[model samples]
Target: MLAQYLLGKFRALVRLLIQCVSPRQVKLETATYLRGSKTSELDDEDHNVVEWAFSGAYDGDKPILIDAENPARSLSKNKSLDLVTRLSGSFEPGSTVCLHLQNNILYPILVLAILATGCKWTGTNPACTRSELEDHLRVSRSKYIITSEDHEDMVFDVLCRMDEDIELILFSDVTVERPPSKDGKHPTLHDLLANSTFLPLESRYQRLSARTAATLMASSGTTGLPKMAIRAHGALVCESRSDELQDAHKPYKIRRLFCTPMFHAYSFPKMVINPLRQGQPTYYMQRFDDTFIQKLSLYSITDIITVPPILSRLVDQARGGDAKPLLQSLRTIICAGAPLTVKLRDEFIQLFSNPPQLIQEWGMTECGCISRAGDLDADMPTTVGRPVAGYLVKISQEERVEIPGGGFASELLVKGPQLMDCYLGDDSATASHVTSDGWYKTGDVGYLDARGRIFLVDRAKDIIKVNGWQVSAAELEKTVLQVPGVMDAAALSMGHSLDEHPYICVVRTDHGVSEKEIREVLRSQLSRYKGSRCELQFVDGLPRAASGKLLRRKLKAQLTHREK
Candidate 1:
């Protein structure tokens, strides 16, 4: 009894010592950097993501993944695991599996099956044009393409043109009762799942280590063509584990409504691993449409992870006063992908009767979610909160010099377990983005506050320099969006690098607001150096990627072509 008491006291003392030694911000040499309050040791674990995800204790018969389009189409834990085990025998080890399908109930299951078989998985947008699809296939060097019947012709054509002997597989919605492939040339996912055999519990399946590449997520090609980012099993496992730890303290259960594309990195891990691990019911929307507001109320969705454009649309709908009651069931709205402006954040929160916490997270395809705003930091509108567990953040100027807190915005650098292994097949590109010392240059210009909160100014490449002043395009775009008649806006630099000018493209409402009025508003709200010489062009709509990031390079190319 005495020994037991002593051991308990020793554990308590160790916990107290750790708390005392933990610092909110660490000083490294002359620069101050921020480290996550929590640290995870799963970075070096030699385990496959599939094994880690399924190891969680959860109800096997619970309907955790449901289709919002057809409520009857749902997957319980047992059903999903069964499908995964059966389909795991289809792929050979170390081959790449590419998915070209829209958001559906079966997508996540396919992702799991691919990873379980010791193969790399990549997904392309279903709506990609023929050439774009070909480019993706060429870059990913995918050995097998899994697509729906709707896209089979396009996929076949692209494969034929490339003269690659890639196998093609067809997928159907979970609700469909697909027949076996008549020709046997291309098998359906259902056909694979119906196979009686399972993967041998022996040496046939290769063991996956932490460093093994599990996913090849395509980066959002905002600047140019998309590159496939290789993510290791350990990285994904670390990311999911971090999120699970963070949510462990929450008081209420999370019932998520996921409308974001499953193919993108922003939503991939969350959709594939989180719901099952947490034993939470997640509704999958094929696409965000007119029925979104009603579905939220019908399902009593407590949480949603979406992009800013969808939130803006929701805020606009809330103006009618009907959406207020429908949205009251929501307890949290986590926005990522593109920047969420202070104006939109505040406006949207105020519209809710019982306002849901609108949290903004900062991250990219190359890295998983870097930071997320907490409930306490919600009032600090512009901040993306502090770094999560296993992340270190710093700022770099011209010579890797760190500026003091609240000083001018510098390029943000992050080191974390969730960082992608490499830009797949592009070693030079990987070296250019990541420094030798292990810091990943985010290419985003932001500053760390004294409190260690991060505030994103703009993408380093998107900062427009006019005269001697550096202006943030995101800030300017935010200001433009506040105008009453403006529905959407994007800011671009229109001149040479040394001498650049701001050009604002806007999509106006039917209210028919004039250009002079927008300029007047900008002139009143912004300084002369920031807004005076701005040029405005009215357009029907702005082009954006599936992740809601503005396609600025594509837009600039279109504008330049028109001028020519």
Candidate 2:
């Protein structure tokens, strides 16, 4: 295994050197490209036929969702189609639905069912509070919400506060004795599907156009709350059929386990929807656990969809020599959502005798996937590779720093077909993100190599990453302000990449307020990733400009000085 690993690495290095010596343009072949006006190639009259196509690909006895129950329960593709057909009746055409279920078997079926009926959908983070839930509902203006039985009470409370007649569907099979009869409007997903007959009406999907919003994706913001980016049907379709790998000649069989939250853009559309379209199977977990690492062997996982922190944990386990033997079947590992530190990447390569081919991708919610590492001469681990097809990337130099391999540092700007339609109900915000000529300001600082690969340096946005999840510094400051005696607060990132932690410096109005009390209040209000293990410090005051603008660079410098 060690010899094979060395041989593979040597081959990759040779390929990189050869490509560098004899550089060639990777041309976009128009003949092989699949062009469609909508999610499917079917005309308006045949639009409803798309649902049947999904089932037809895997009609035979093939399982879809597999979880790590004592004895794993799997659902066949045919059985899933039946449930989706019945659930389609509950949703109306041209309406938005909120899908907030944790990583459960019902997620993929519910998503396809919503798309089948031409109703737009958006996902909600399970960590959201009632107030955040209310804000998400208001911003998306959804007509229905589908959540697990665990969140029934919270969903009800938030809906009542909204004062809207939104329908609620609890995605659960566990029967509970209610007060003789509950409200007819709020029904369990089991009851809804069991009560309705499977009506395979073609008209249900016919009215949807390519321009219709298929998803209301959330974009992490540096200030205020997260903005809703409206992803169109055309955008999803393009991403689903993206032929980014030029070396592939035939279909590749993938049995993957996706550990990221389903609400994320990468895990949802790329790992779930795209795999479903290709008739591939993906396993799910409510969250990462000890059992999750064990399933790599149990399920014979060929591919893994993961983020940086999870990889860090895996590295730790492998170093202990407990998890190394179980990872033999892994052929590919794709890392995204956060920076993959060079140290971690090298450690992973050294630990496994026959390591999986590591690939890195760089993208944002606004644009589906801009670059893939496989397409460029990725001799350096920091480089994120060249832009994928149908997208163009350029650098807007804000810094004069130049790197040896990666060129001058600047703000990365992009223009692509998969760019989102707009931010929901916020035209000014939409206009601010996108340029008049169509390029979207990614707010990420990076440099482009001569070969077109992008290498990131820093972020222009004031955000911190906790386990690859974006935590807004502004949002943290706002939450800290809610605590009594917190006159002023500022949050900044400490360390780099996945090692980064949210560090807060607070100015107290009252001397009685202790750090423990303030931290307890924050933990209650914010999610665990944002609050639980955050570093807190009492400061005299946060640096600010005369016009009340936060001088974050100065605060960062102060932190540097303190560490020194």
Candidate 3:
């Protein structure tokens, strides 16, 4: 440990000396460096000056989010800036806005404007059901919702059902007929932007403290409702700046293609900020589908910011000799949001010539990015690398249990500036996850190597990863229990790795209800991914403790024993 510490310090010293002597010029494009970054007037107010600089960092005129529907369709950074200006003037300062639109080019502008106005912003996955969306809206307490004609029906349904006092701001062309406001005019997002004569200078340049809550995002919960996490203004700024600095040091420009939901924290930086700062174009996917391989070759995508399932599909495509030419253009591929199996990673590397830099990042909604493993030894395919810059990692063994690799497996604890303030409106949940001093309990059971690389073994919480999306076991269990004959149900992951499928074990009450009927009921309630590929088992009884709490581990053991 002492030797490793000394070696780390020595490397740091060498880097500092090299930086001092060489003094490399900041070579980032206009989007990263503001033209008027050094203002003489606000020199006295350091926080205000910092805010000005942070806002200005995204002032470039380049296209940020490109429309996937039409390759020619794109939105420039300036258009977003104008919209932000208009939005600031339209809404009260420091107000919270919930953006729940489909993957569109306008998302970047909305995010920037929200941050610039010193207001809080929250967004939900468009795939979320009205009930799920309602839960998020009720928790966040967002009065203004920015959606489009595409999701108008669903959004309106949520609004009507909840009876929450919220305003709808349409971004695209208004196709739905609705009653006008008391002012007797149907106002759209475009109308607001078109009518604005000048920027709302006051709100646009509002001086916000670093600790102010900038984003209130939701967790991909393993149980119950999704927990809201408040990300501070300083945390966002720091992460963006870090990306900028990293890009400055890179030799080649990054033309990233983003298809993940814009609301997700994993996708936000890559989709909106990182590509913008690098002066590189970001192509937004309407959805990840069969057309993805076509887009890669069509747009000459240099980097793909996607999940494991997409990568697995790409690998399968390569095996069929379809993705040879286009795959070469990809220099880097970032996989996150769910675990990437060693089999998938190895196949990806073997299939491509000059294989893309495969970077596996581990993070949750509450914490932006925890660890990223860029370079890994062939033997250590499970390694998630060390903690990212400005984060610390330590394993807190809840119980002394032997691990497979001759070590004790334990829960991973993280401490970082980018860690969330708290789970919004859920004091108990927040308190449980966050320690008294600082450490955030990442409910991931993993072991650290001698070199500090993290290898995940199991989940402390019961969550199923389906195609890189988190499907809560409890949530699925709830859906299964709703079936007519199901007295009790428990959901678990069927596949070992990337082929993860949600499987359910059920205790039936009625004799007439068949497995097919139960499946049909579940299919009606849950999404396609969660409903399909689900294997059901009729169990005589569910393993439970005396207090009626589930003995999941014991049930899993019984199932494994039966399979053998």
Candidate 4:
């Protein structure tokens, strides 16, 4: 045992030395599959994720999580662990617990408690409509749901519609006091935590394995209805450590402002798991709004993980007046979920005298972050950088032929420790996406550069053929966004595949730009064949998922209904 322990430490030291001395360089053409520089097999032990999280290098007394709205309410590492132990007895082992609340101080602790009790966890957007909530509940097959008082009616209505006997638990704000529950059917979280017996940490079930499903996050569902993606404990554990190779050499203090929805996979591990493991302090905002700039200045936040739309909003706010003072404390902005446009990236950088580093990440709900552009490669803003440690990426044509570097755009296939175990209860769907050889089809179309950097073009299903040439809807939308007055845009095929033309739905500012001017700009910016047969429609807004992904299918369906 001692020799094995020393060997494991030696291996970790070697990996760190290699990463620090010379980062793994990607030799794109050396093999059919491109692997990251650092690699290791994760231990597939029956370790609970909560235990792994608490075993990090965090101070017991320092505040780890704070409620931005009510600064007084916070949790340190020790306090959080105690809360998790107390709440663990409230859940049944092996049952699924669903959270339907916005970002709050107790969100991460609640997730830990649920996992600690050997319960699988999932979350739905609190703003989801009845139908959407019904779909989520039905798919997750949750036995209990925890929601806030504001959304209790909606949850009850959805439960009634589904006719499922799922127990509902109201989540009370820790900062505010509320009367005890009058109905036995629904008890508030505060009540449960107070009344439930505290189970000794060692007395809890200890049968969890790496393959145990820890979370069931809903996919972005931009193409259709959302599907529950099953993420195993091992995958999430690997994902939480993804940045170690890049960040170990430069350990800096980070005070993060986490406003992104916690329900989405993009924010889940980053906000809940990483902060605890890294000993970083995070302020939780219920939602983002006009006061976002104020909150940044108020909290003196150093870093943020967000999407492109929020950055666009910041750029617009900067244009109104000087924003450097409010944003002066920000050191880094990690953008993911959707592709970041060059125009927006440049504009955002120009906001500060000393611009914070903007790192673009690429991944999906089925997998945690696949790649991230580090500070060293910040100049290449267009690319999503190379695959991070433990991930292998390859580009493949529809016929499963591997494409070499600098080839045309094809579907991106990835094999990684962070890949989802399966889509919950959907073997057919899982089989269709994961190949027999274990590559997970990403459904994204992009090519790797000579340096092994990934440049995403568009979704495979979103590509339209015009005049026998394939065109990317994302590329078209990016071009449209370059127009001065365009605030938002979505590009889609207007007709059948063989005879398709680009149709752009745009939301414009008060600048009053004409469709003719936009067409002229597109003609100058894009290929003649790609731009000539384009149609434009000005709308107030475009449909988008909670993650800021364009709902192209929804937009197409709306247009089809209008044409009918």
Candidate 5:
């Protein structure tokens, strides 16, 4: 009753405020309509943020539930400036906005938007063409773009390709190569920020629709075309509950290191955006380096968002005395992307003062974070953790059985608002992935136990059937990475032979581990049937994206070329 009463008061207050701001009397029903209806047979889970907003739950008057108090040396010299100044200027209501740049800078902007009284911050892919960029701008209905000096030309060029008048916020004054005549157009990012002024925009009871674009991010297009992933505010509200995935929210002022590309799911949701709701400072590496990670304690850093390979580098650092006790300051470390092996996870835990939690989260570009296993118990390194709060996941039976529990690990399907509304410009692809029932079929295979924890076995695409026996490529790579001097490994099957075993390629580190040593290690780990048929090839490093995800298909392409 108390919650209901407070919500009623909140609605009245916002109604009064909106009328006061607009000269003409605002449309009570048209301006903010909070209702519940559906055309689908099964739409019980649909949540509308706009409805919640009108009722006060999502009203703009709510202070950020996520706390931001980093006493530790987390905030960068520039991040402090970004946390306030940037949002105050860019998120003015009634004005359209667009943000383009690299992944490293968008983290802070996402944080600022949550505090911007219901402003929508649309994103564009850095690798997108002028055509795609312009199309997204027109469709999204953005008025301005917050860009950097590096992208000034591209943004202006993209603008020229569009019909709308565009505004910009540039951080640096940069120009291209000098010409003899020196008669080319050039402008600084600072030029716009200084001249642009933003007024106070406080519209109470503001909430985005459940289907409204929460924030825009693009997929890397490993399989096909790059597409925009639409996230609705209600999904964000659900994703915001991801904080509960951590056993207890530690109230600490610690510097968090961000090295992953924030545009994708690997880091943006799990590492950067989620942590900000806690109100801690996150330091950006703009670029990644092992040495930069090695010297983090010098900055009083306690947490880091990284992939396994980077952790492998840190483990290498621990083997030496260079980073030493200073590395001890690292309170917690998180890993995502590829699976972490038992050997690697154990080594990382031992190096920590008291085994920092190794939070392994699982998700994709289309769906934000779905489940997170806070840390791997020594017994269950292969098992990714439980589903985050407000999330439900199930695995389909590989074969049709009389009755199969969706809870069992099969093909992991997620049903949550945190999922993308569609793959930009590709309705067929979107429909193919998302079922009419609101369940998204994740290509990766995993099962949930009674505890609701998600354990991934392998990607369905990478699974190989050997005489009707199931074989996991990831299982092979995990064993290969354990060989003495072997730094990294990846596995893939090339062909279906008489017995159905395909060619497997192994990428190695510069640690001098040889083919013979790797083969011997696999022999010890695998059965004779699996081991005798294996082949090994040594290469420099695995082919991966900027975000550190391996592209086995690319590796196979490289191998095919060599054979040709």
Candidate 6:
């Protein structure tokens, strides 16, 4: 493993060096250009060509010119300059092209535009929703979206909803929507691609700097509406951004993990993409199932990124002596989305006995992964670790907010390349939250210790005003989950009455545990007022998206539907 990692790095360093000094305009290493591949046997020409490709071949291994005559032609010297003349021209820095994958066919122009000049391209699936598709659309500000015959409906939906104007064509050709008596929607992605002719990329678009914003992604913000976050082209300057690397501080090969869906900003950036940039394989669960998660080792997985809920299931499975060796094969396991409690942390450490290190990360949609710590695996006090590179963070207390260190527990504000440019076209809402300077108001309640570890308390939106006091729904939910039979809990203020009391409901698990035991557990651990202020209800499970985010609206709807 070490040999493979070192070889990959050595090749990358060589490639970086060649790009700076040599004029490499031709050739690519079809296999070696990727981040971390297991195969080693290759010709000497492939090695040097990979080195040149990394430096200049289509802006770093995008496969523009391909295996041309005499593969080692340097772009600077006359020998390579001739090859460059034969090949495509340079690309703008911020162009992030979207590869609309259809069956196995690769479109020629789509390949040239993306591979020609180091412009980045990311592949997408057809099943993505309009809002889900918009994240990538907004994140990447994608140059062109290539879609097949069937997926144009979703693309049109997003284009209609977007505030920014975007140029559209199809993966197949120019689309012509069959008119309903000349009054119908336009043609589809397939039609557009099939009919479109090659036009020179506008000259103005060719000179963009790499630091310029290329893409954007949206997430469920603390506000009721979705907020867009920017993902700059510069974010991928390094082959392996250290922040997303495995804890060993090594570029580990990312293999398979299916617990998370691709649509989530967290999973898309951290799990799926970070690895793909490094050319590692990622297998998504598509959907999660306990027995399948328990049997993952059969497929030879090396890493996994998950939240507390999934980790809890792993512990539950491990407690019964199942999935032991499978987990033993694991390299790095990351956790976020909620705090990893000391009780649960200790249980994992004791059971795994020096198994995969648990990293508790703290981040939100406003920015990507901010902090992570290994102390979490050892049962250290919970705090989202220090900020990663290319990011700045500050915590300040306003009138309604409070933190332990005077300003320690205030709203966390972040500014970084990964921050979104704006929410589509909602300028008023975007201007209201993002400052003139660039600081985004996170609306998150957290305190940063002197060492920079952040402890999240709750969302400012989820804060419950009770009797002139603020009660954190997170605090209540944490306590409820500790109950022997409780699976999940969510708390929302019913409405502020003159009486000012908390109305909390806990969803208890039916894992053969009784409601009497659950309520008794809460009563024994909580104060009389706190204990008596809540009701216990047995539920199958809390409503969640494929990405494991709670859908509070659905929970509220479920309560209303049941009441009726």
> Scored by Cα lDDT, where does model 6 land?
0.50
Cα lDDT of model 4 by residue, 246-356, tens digit: 556533467889888897777888878877777877898998886888889998887898777688788788786676578867767888866677677767866765556
The residue-by-residue lDDT of candidate 1 on 1-564, one tens digit each, is 354345435544543464465333554222347887555544455667777766768889989889998888898888877777777868777889999988887787888888878899999778666766776787888899999887888788888889787889888554466666677557887777676376642232348777889998776333334578898887888888877876676556788898888887778888888887778899999777767888899998988987776887787887889777888778778887666676677677677544556777787778888998866564356678889888899988563333443246678899987888888788877898889988998888777776778877556566665542345687678778889999999999876422357999999999968988888877765557668768899999888999999999799888899889
Per model, how many backbone clashes are there?
A: 0, 0, 0, 0, 18, 37
lDDT of 3 by residue, 1-564 (tens): 354345435534543454354212432111110111112211222232124333545547767657766756666656554555665555656777899887777677777666766667899877677767887888888878888767887888888888678888777532222443335223576665555557554556556776778788877565656778988866665555544544565446677777788788888766666554445777888678878887887888877877888888887788877566668677677788788887788777666545556788888878887777764433355777766656677878476456643557778888766688998778898898999988888888877766557778888877777777777788788777777767888877777667778778888886535888888876776667767878888888989999999988889889999999
lDDT score, candidate 4, position 545: 93
Better of 3 and 5 by lDDT: 3
Q: Model 5 — TM-score against the truth?
A: 0.59
Residue 297 lDDT, candidate 5, scale 0-100: 73
Q: Is candidate 3 or candidate 4 better by lDDT?
A: 4
Per-model TM-score versus the true fold: 0.75, 0.86, 0.84, 0.75, 0.59, 0.52
Assess each prediction's global lDDT (C-alpha) against the native.
0.76, 0.71, 0.70, 0.76, 0.55, 0.50
Candidate 5, superposed: residue stretches over 4 Å from native:
1-98, 103-107, 110-145, 153-169, 173-197, 204-211, 220-223, 244-253, 270-276, 397-409, 461-564
lDDT of 6 at 4: 52
What does the lDDT come to for candidate 1?
Answer: 0.76
**TM-score winner between candidates 3 and 4:** 3
Distance from true location, Cα of 57 in model 2, Å: 4.1
Model 1 Cα shift for residue 202 (angstroms):
9.1
Model 2 misplacement above 4 A = 1-60, 70-72, 173-185, 194-198, 243-252, 375-378, 397-407, 510-512
lDDT (tens digit, per residue) of candidate 6 on 319-382: 8775666576565667776566766665665554334456777666446566667632132345
lDDT by residue (tens digit), candidate 2, 158-204 = 88878887888877642222332255546777676656656773455
